[model samples]
Target: MTDRAGHRKAAVWGAGGWVVGVLGVLVALPLAARDRLPDRLATHWDASGGPDSSMPFWAATFVPALIWVAMAAAVVLVQWRARKSAGGAAPGWVGATLGFGGATLLGAQASIVRANLDHTDWREAGSVTVWVVVTLAAAVAVGAAALWAGHRARVTVPPVAGPTMEIPEGQRFVWLSRTSNPWLHVTAAVTGVVAVGASAASVGGLTGAEAVLLAGPLALATVVVLCCASVQARVSEKGLDVTFGPLGWPARRWAAEDIASARVETRTAAQVGGWGYRLNGLGTTVMLRGGECLVIRTVKGKDFAVSVDDAERGAALLNSLIGQRSRG
Candidate 1:
């Protein structure tokens, strides 16, 4: 789409999504729950797939609706302002996504509320598994949408200079390593232990099936931490490389000629949301945790950085390789 058209279309979608989502929570939900809202509504859930907390009907409905309204307004306003930036930026894709997804989520929750409003036995009214499924799906959808849109907004494609940065069949090799924080290990260990204890405590609140379903992702997250706790970085005249231990997943290499610059940078979670693999204006960043990073800017202005020890040496070596190759 043309810039003007894309801007208009995105704005319209943002506004409409916010409006529909808010309206669904305010009007559609109330109508659906009509006479069913009990003296007190089920507002919170416990481990056993039962309602453990209650709220007055007005507070239960209005409080959430107010939050949605605020979020929706903020999203639309931010997006509109971001589009006006020099590079035609989109509002923080994160916010746009939340605007879009938050509404959908709140609406979904409203539906669940209406569905599960059986005061006679609120615990038995709705499927806890269903709530989990809807929420996960909504969150994933929002993230996916934001990433796609953000990529379009932030990255300007670089000009290809005819197969740049090709190594002559392993003619040269260089390697280095970067160790992560021991504190990260401690955090992961604590999380795993806490998760284990929580799961055990809450197992009685759910059926055997519910427990298994919920355990799936938590188990996967723990496994990921175990596998990717440390990052090993390597740089060669050929390019740059990084790999994770244990699983050794996502082994990556970049060509030296493609690099515009390599610089030492310190990044924060607020800059790229959270750690792990993050994307922002600079491009893909494989951040293990927040701290010093070696950022490589591509010829196209795209970038990829990683937080690791000895970032200065890595950036210097990588830059020297690029300089030497260009001089050759």
Candidate 2:
């Protein structure tokens, strides 16, 4: 399936699972509490059937579930409207999905506990509600602050709009600004999110549940390794910056003068050998699935290569610029 389809499918599955989980909780609560609470309390009263039961089933579960339903509805509405609009505004579904989906899972767990366990009184439920509200409010505040800061810090970066071949004269340093493939950008974004999320989830203290967090890190590391394929060589007047691990920023730089020659080439997974940045007997390796390479020969008689998308065009551009530099 296409990546977009996959993302949509995952979202649908998550929502579906949440609905199923809610039903499971509803079914299990009655069974789990039958022997523990009186018949009136167990069947007619709150799910727990407790004394001084100030809150009813509808009061706790009904309200939250309705809120979840409303949020989901809003997500659909916003996305539909966004589709009719121009210029890709960050989708409202992003926030709605993250917020409602997360809240549903958490809120459901709290609901189940309150319904099944007598220890979880209305006071505890109130506390949980307060905590959730406070946390949500704090998150909004922080997000607003971050948006303001980002806007304040934002600076316009003009495209490299001039002649493709002409290297600006006497330019001590110039950062390459080029539009990469949209698919690549999407892939990078997904890989980065998975890697970062897994890393965070891997940390202890998240939950007492015996979740093997190490799996997150391992999965993150693997995705990071694969995402390194997108980084095109970054050209500067002094040197070229090539990525090492993941589709993140490059960590290695090779001087322009050190480069003996640059050419466009292709390689298979075998030719690349190993992951991460590997200096094989061939050249500097950036991507594992080698299709196009920007091969560079360092001054030390070692050739380094970075596998980039549209490497031939990139090589030509670099060659033109570098050649211009040599002449001037």
Candidate 3:
């Protein structure tokens, strides 16, 4: 689309989305007011022990709707500004705004449902789960819509040179593209799914047996994610890119020359203080849990770390790579 056309389209969508959102809020406002009513005034069944007669439907509706309105307004504003940028920038912002707004609305609904449902009772077995599914689906839909809209607004073309690996001296940057692994990505995705499920179940007051069953999946996923991920690293001429999340890049990089020394470091969860890739207060990082890691100290004494199956071997490989590059 032309810049003017794209701008106009974005503006229309933004305005319409905001309008719909405002309507939703107006519809929901009555739910929130339910909390204000005396106990005897509540006509709906209160067996769930939800906040008594005060449970106003309008208030419940309004809170989420209000949030959506704000998000929609932001989206419109971004769309208006995008006309001048005339490229992919405006689309990105609009899509992000839409996705963010949708998420806020979904979150508001979730909060309300969570407050009303007693998932621990098992009597509400399907209720909370259904709401959870809806919320997740809605969030995904919003994100997908944003992505689609953003794509529509931009010209589609692959980069002529892709990403560069030319790291200049004194610059603290690393590039890792050649080492993207499909297996590691799969493992991370599985881990996240398990973790989220377990956490959700536990949150619903599933203590003792139920909690164990729910939390068990999460624990297992966490362990598997950490264990399977410890050996992988993304390496390029620029630097090493570490992997943590399932679907995308979850690493930070550093320059080769800045790395003054290289070594393998072994650490436990307690010593490293938990799992995944983390930069702690001491400007140090521990990748994964109970694994060997390639630890490189920068000239500034900061650590650039990556998890690899053979830490020493990885460190040696890194050293050799750096040496070759420097000599060349």
Model number with the top lDDT = 1
Q: What is the lDDT of residue 301 in candidate 2?
A: 79
RMSD of each: 15.9, 8.5, 14.4
Model 2 misplaced regions, further than 4 Å: 1-84, 87-209, 212-232, 236-238, 243-247, 274-279, 288-290
Give the lDDT of residue 53 in candidate 3. 35
Whole-model lDDT, model 3? 0.48
Question: Highest TM-score among the candidates is held by which one?
Answer: 2
Sorting all predicted structures by TM-score, with the top scorer first, yields: 2, 1, 3
lDDT of each: 0.58, 0.46, 0.48
| Per-model TM-score versus the true fold | 0.41, 0.51, 0.34
Worst 10 residues of 3 by lDDT: 173-182
Q: Candidate 3, residues 1-328: lDDT per residue as tens digits? A: 3323433443354435435543443344334334432222221224453333323444554555666676677766766677557652555556655664555454435344434443333123223344445666766775775565445434332211324333354444322211122333345445544443333333433233664676577666655553334223544456555544322324456656666667887765566556544567535654444556677877787876554444564465467557756677
Count clashing residue pairs per candidate: 1, 3, 28
State the lDDT of candidate 2 residue by residue for 72-142, as single tens digits. 56766676677568342335334435444543444343433433344333433222343345446644653
How far is 238's C-alpha from truth in model 1 (Å)? 2.3
The candidate, 2 or 3, that scores higher on lDDT is 3
Please give the distance, in angstroms, between residue 164's alpha carbon in candidate 2 and its true position after superposition. 7.4
